[model samples]
Target: MSIMLKEMKAGDQGRVQGFAAGGQAYRRKLLAMGLTPGVEFLVVRVAPMGDPVEVRVRGTSVSLRKDEAATLNVERMP
Candidate 1:
């Protein structure tokens, strides 16, 4: 099943399916933040209120806001 990036739990791994955000700038920012398609990512943590989630990708830990993370579509890894 596909899910929003923010909904993923810690230790979950997935491949980026696509981004739902509009405009090139938002897409670019997401890409720079390591949300590119085909890349695998692991959810590291979710803040207490769940507004921001941390993910490990490209050997780095990146934090994403709930709204921004929602734009990313991902499928769970087998």
Candidate 2:
């Protein structure tokens, strides 16, 4: 099923479907953080209060705010 990036739980892995926002710069920023569409990522942790979420992508850990994370659409992996 499709879900917002911020909604992913710890240890959950998914492939990026798309970004909610449309813009070259926004896409570039996400790409810079290794969050390119079609790339797989694992949710590592969610900070208390859930403002920021940590994810493992391309062997690197990146933290993103809920707003930013929400922009990403992902599908849970088996």
What C-alpha lDDT, on a 0 to 100 scale, does residue 61 get in candidate 1?
Answer: 94
For model 1, where is the 10-residue window of minimal lDDT?
Answer: 19-28
Error of 2 at 12 (Å): 0.7
lDDT by residue for model 2 (1-78), tens: 788887778988999998886545466678789898899988999988887899999999999887778778899999
Model 1's number of clashes is 0
Model 2 misplaced regions, further than 4 Å:
22-25
Summed over model 2, clashes come to 0
Q: Write the per-residue lDDT of candidate 1 for residues 1-78, one digit (tens) a residue.
A: 778887778888999998875635467888988779889988899998887899899999989888778788899897
Among residues 3 or more apart in sequence or in different chains, the pairs in candidate 1 whose N, CA or C atoms overlap within 3 Å are none
* Alpha-carbon RMSD, each predicted model: 1.6, 1.7
Give the Cα-based TM-score of candidate 2 against the true structure.
Answer: 0.87
